[model samples]
Target: MDSSTHKLYHEHDFDSRQFLENYFSDKPDMVFGDDSLTFLIENFRHVFTVGHINGDILIDLSIGSFVHHLYSACEFFKNIIVLKVNNRCIMELKRWVDDRTGAFYWGHTSTILQEKEENSDQFEDQNAKLRSAIQHIVKYDLEKENMTDPLVLPLADCVLSAWLLDVISKDQDDYIRYFRKFSRLLKPGGHVILIGVLNITYFTVGKDKFQGFPYDEDFVRKALAGEGFIIDYCKVQERTAVSDLIDYKAVIFIAAHKEK
Candidate 1:
């Protein structure tokens, strides 16, 4: 397999709609199942509910235009700043934020969060709150020293990313370098939460395959430790969804805070 053929996410024009339909949609046979959705939502709810993790500002650097993971965080953080590597993803997310007619439906995810929280808020209201909490959605450049250059973003009290590092990094050294840049957004002693798929080498969207950097739990532990972060919670779940769209073996979630 020529790794060169596997494009980094930002290097190619992505099919955002196709990507959402294949993975994030609520279809019964979606590549990522309801269990994965629940896993992400429940874990976020628990981490934020623990009291210490909640903060005034949160920086979100997740891959794609997905906002399902933010339902729980909206309640904890006063504001959220989303950074994206491409304008396509930024526009897709803005459609949802502006309540456009053809935006991706995320009501099911809202239902999951409501069920987890034991609350019965209407889906519209839940989504509206999330939209309100989002302070800005800006495009970024990975090669730049300050990803969001010309606009120095305030250091956030917490940084959260899902399935981003691997897709954007070409190798282990790149992974660590990117992680260090990511962590620089966090205030000292602030927390970071990461959601990743283990052993996934590639994923397809609309016939275009993108590369993923494969790694394991131990590597993540060491990566965080080397970055001066102390892990507080970690969980892994065997792949529950049956799909060929991606070859991930499992999913992992980690919560940690900078030791400085």
Candidate 2:
């Protein structure tokens, strides 16, 4: 992998604080990630409405620095463990979850999700619940034979990953292999929720660009099926805001269950 693609996400170039300010904050023009949060919350509500997703544990596989995507899942499951690729990302998450220093703002994301649901949620209470739902935040290394090796992470009843496979990978083959590795963390008949930026080759973190696997919906479907998952729900959200920060055409959300 090229240095620019891989190194951009390391401590030097990647800033969790800047990440939120650019993407997750309530800024009127935060076009980098608003659509993704909106799309994920909508699909999460629909899936939970028709089906039962509650279980003992749900693992979030390398969610980068984002936290609010799991807000809806917290309603169905009590325990949510988030895994990240580096200590920077993990510490960034803990700052928010543990209410420590240097925590980036998530009120915008929390409020938006709470409003979409039927229940009325106070901003403070909602954030508290979100913090409570996250049980642990650990660092994960995909280069290990098993990403959760040494720790022996419990096989989760559900796993959630967003744009992880695309960004961490060097190529399509590596992406599929990484996807399969993450799938092993799920129990039989477990659900895996995935979000991807379709046809994107790279996206910016600060000023540097990082690689994105250029894959379409069909590639994702075939990859998941090959990994023994059955796609149950799928939604594609087109780019609504025009921004030069990222060059992606659409956002995809898929909920798939492992074959028993």
Task: Find the candidate with the highest lDDT and give its number.
Answer: 1
Q: How many residue pairs clash in each candidate?
A: 0, 0
lDDT of 2 at 227: 88
Residue-wise lDDT of candidate 1 within 138-232, one digit each (tens)? 99999899999989999999999999997988777988999999999999899999999998899889878899999999999999999999999
For each candidate, the alpha-carbon lDDT, in order, equals 0.88, 0.77
RMSD of each: 1.4, 2.4
Residue-level lDDT of model 2, residues 113-231, one tens digit each, is 76776766444586777788888887767779876667888889999888777777767798888888888888889999898888877766676666666788998999999888999
Tell me the TM-score of model 1. 0.96
Return the lDDT, model 2, position 226.
Answer: 87
Alpha-carbon TM-score of each model against the true structure: 0.96, 0.91
